[model samples]
Target: MGQVDPHRPPWVFDCKLTARTTPNPEKFDEALRQHVGRPGHWIDLEVRGDCSDAELELIRRLAQEADTRPVVVRHVAKLISAGQEEAGHDEPS
Candidate 1:
């Protein structure tokens, strides 16, 4: 995990969205390519925070008529410690 800087604002997903509509009808797919993978043909589009006006407009349009398709959200993977590893203890039988 990355350390947080006190001066900068914490990462926020205020604009996070899950839309089921495809993006084939949009004209500005290139602008959101980095933010929305496969924007032109994606079945699901997840929008994070901090998007430009143009990008936001496209996202807003997508959200208006989202379909009933299932939404897919990817989560960050994390490693967990059970304390034994840190305390130099092995698994007990």
Candidate 2:
């Protein structure tokens, strides 16, 4: 959590790291698609801080135009807070 920066979107708290991988544009999209399709439940794609303009655009597409394969999605950005960050937890600056 941004204990030092209050203006940070509350959406920051609700994020869950569903995957980690090398920087490959195709794989980023592919992995997110697969993850949201997992059989356990419906997953809303929540996005926060982006490292680049490309990434911002990518998230925009996913949260807007991403209806490719295995799922039909017309996403709406609904912010849900997971409250505060736990001890020893940190988000990249």
Candidate 3:
């Protein structure tokens, strides 16, 4: 895990979502691809505290609406971690 910066704003907990709600499995897969692959299609969301009530509700709704099993959802934490790693590579020895 990377060090959490104390000075950074609380937006760090903010997550990005990828969703699909087609009526069939095949079309749902395509929707997932379109939302996950394209930029801006993913929405930025924040959990006020450690956990987010609204986010959970949205996830539940998405799961219920998904046409296929295992509704996929990705968060921004991984992205932030990757960026941190990239930046760390340039740090002074």
Candidate 4:
């Protein structure tokens, strides 16, 4: 882990997902159709900094609406750290 920068704010994280049907192959396409492609179904979302209350609510609703369970999600963010540079601590060649 890197040292946190006192002067900067914590970075926000985001994610986008495209998920298909069930674990079973026979219902895979159908599940995707019902969960992703159908009207009133949500296919993707952007999660920010652990997500906002509204966003979290939407995600929960989407999960229920799609009749799906969330396993894992990938996140992207900018990492910032403040520390002494160690480049100079080296032996002479």
- Report how far residue 57 has shifted in candidate 3, in Å: 3.3
- What TM-score would every model get versus the actual structure? 0.21, 0.29, 0.26, 0.24
Lowest lDDT 10-residue stretch of candidate 4: 78-87
Encode model 4's per-residue lDDT on 8-84: one tens digit a residue. Answer: 63653223333343666454345545545544433454343445567667555644555554422223332323322
lDDT at 81, model 4: 31
Sorted by lDDT, highest first, which candidate order results?
Answer: 2, 4, 3, 1
Best candidate according to TM-score? 2
lDDT of 2 by residue, 1-93 (tens): 436655765446655544343356574456665545545444455443324557655565663444433333333333335664343356689
Alpha-carbon runs more than 4 Å astray in model 4? 1-46, 68-93
Badly placed stretches (over 4 Å) of model 1 are 1-49, 67-93
Candidate 1: worst-modelled 10 consecutive residues by lDDT: 75-84
What local lDDT does model 3 show for residue 91?
A: 62
How well does model 2 score by local distance difference test?
0.48
Model 2 misplaced regions, further than 4 Å: 1-28, 38-43, 48-57, 68-93
**lDDT scores of the candidates, listed in order:** 0.43, 0.48, 0.44, 0.45
Q: On a 0 to 100 scale, what is the lDDT of residue 54 in model 4?
A: 70
